[model samples]
Target: MTKEHILPKWMREEFPELAREPVFQGSQNEHDGPTPDGPRTVYRGGKEESGPFNRQAPVVCGPCNNGWMSQLETNVHEPLSRMIRGLPTVLTSERQAVVALWSAKTLMVAYRAPHFGPRPRPEVILPVDAERLYQDRALGPMMVMGLANYQPTPYAREPLYVQSFTRMEHEGGAYSYCATLRIGHFAAQLVRCPDGMYPPLGQIPPHLVLLRPGASAVHWPPSRPIRAGAEWDSFVNLPEETGT
Candidate 1:
């Protein structure tokens, strides 16, 4: 039981709408379910659980979980949630960074989950830049982020589905390791590479818009009432025929 890292009081003040955010008090062990990996799966929500960060999983540790990260959650919550609730959103670089950081944080915690057991394979696990993220509250220089919308399940309770996978890309005489996260209607991909080896967002297979660091905002969903599925895999494994 992680008692020390409770949700901070300041969060409620910053995002009062959080009061409406539904909290799932289901048995953690019962709620324990298999999380999707490339083709296999790993169990999440077991003996120990952290959470309710704005009613989402607070899967990181004390200092790494609150304050700084909380601010990122706050900045993007409204826009992201509104987009999920069927509204137009202008995703700015700043907000996109929030998506990247939050996705990376989720991956970081997943990497540390006990169910992965002793000595999980290194390639499947994300090399999280937690120290850099905690210190600066920003994506490390090597990381790039992007986003897109997908069809949703009709009238489903707000779902905060998030999934990540690691990939190796060869560039600039080295491999650029990256991770992509699918969260609800949007997917945020973060790539960390050696200096000068970073690839731009356009290289990603999905027709995602580049969440360029420090770039201007762009109106997303280019269409109205964007819908998303209930599961993370729905977005991650979206058919190639679908548009972003």
Candidate 2:
């Protein structure tokens, strides 16, 4: 296995400020049994002192890391950098697909990466999802991706942050998983459900623009931007209530 940096080299080189700051890595695992309210969730994991540039995970093999994953990063460098820096840019349908795939890939790596304290239980992105992503280099039909602009506050200024949530039906069977990734002013959320169980698009908040399963071009910097702290918390946790 090879160690893959959680944040790509291009990203670190472009944003030195983020590369220097210490990152806080954490994970939360939730499980709802077959019975409606049987054991809910236990939040595990803690902070790590490493910066985003230095945070590496020995999850992927050498060939995979140097092959398609490398190409994927290269493909996303230009457009993603612009988005993260809040520069004006339009995303064509093809660009949208690339960004969506990159977002999902990043989330998958973060989920597989090690965290401080105990490792969270019940995998968020299943093995099947990972295999499909690796083979097709695209998000599966069961996955939906959304993008939004993020407004950082003085108290909560982290250039790159990722958080994931998984709801389990039994002990180890996951029903749904949602991962939200924020880089500077750009934010993307990827939600995955079982086959034939896609979430309703109408329930998504107006601030988040649908990226995957969309064909037309998308304009950058949406009219509404999600504010840091409480607003961000609400946006990431909204799937619990709205089923998206």
Candidate 3:
């Protein structure tokens, strides 16, 4: 029997809506994909594996927040369970040809476009303000972050549902995926000051946006699109590597 895992409670309380979004749902495990390409499946480390980023057992969690969403750490567990419960048991070649292993880790999220058009795609795993969470030290011995989905966008032709880090779900207002994904193109900071320590201003890196823009220019980089030949693009970034 494979192991199973669940999603965190904060996420369940944070986002009350979930659905399948299969944009790049491809798999290397299926033998019917192309003409037999040698031996696709392999047994390594004394275990049978499927493909790169091979499915791992999940840490499934909850039917909380009125059953809007549930989470799994990975696919090795419930994906198969879901597949089994959602399909027929009778075996057939057509079904075999279409057989696929679910990768809960590869679960797709619907990111509704915000003010920015052309849309943005984010990594499945989310980031959090670990330092802040750790500062309290009581939140948990460890800190982890999560993403939010299923927000209705007002600017698009249809209400957009995006994956983002800014929505305070219970508050009833959310930062749409459009605006959320855009804020990721520049460098960021993870401040870990010990209550009463400050760093010199001149040594700071140029790309961080303050979450709350009050007095100063809110000092953070604004998200923009790739100008066609940029080397790389990602949201998770480190702030200026100034004073250690």
For each of the candidates, the C-alpha root-mean-square deviation to the true structure, in angstroms, is: 8.4, 2.9, 20.3
Write one digit per residue (lDDT tens) for candidate 2, span 1-244. Answer: 9988878998878987776676655555665545664655556556666666776778899999999889989988999999888887688888898899889888888777765345555655677888899888888878888888988887754647555454433333336766778777888888777556766767656687788435889887777889888887777753432233
Q: Runs in model 1 with CA error above 4 Å?
A: 1-61, 115-120, 124-128, 152-162, 169-174, 194-196, 201-206, 222-244
Quantify all predictions' global Cα lDDT against the true fold: 0.48, 0.74, 0.22
Least lDDT summed over 10 consecutive residues: which range in candidate 1? 24-33
At residue 149, give the lDDT of candidate 1: 67
In terms of lDDT, the best-performing candidate is 2
Candidate order by decreasing lDDT:
2, 1, 3
lDDT of 1: 0.48
- The local lDDT score (0 to 100) that residue 37 gets in candidate 2 is 49
Per-residue lDDT over 20-103 for candidate 1, one digit per residue giving the tens place of the 0 to 100 score: 553321111111113322233332222322233443333566664445656666666677666544466777777766656666
lDDT of candidate 3 over 80-155, digit per residue (tens): 2222122213223222111111111122121111111222122112323222222331111121111111112335
- Candidate 3 total steric clashes: 15
TM-score, structure 3 vs. true: 0.21
Global CA lDDT computed for model 3: 0.22
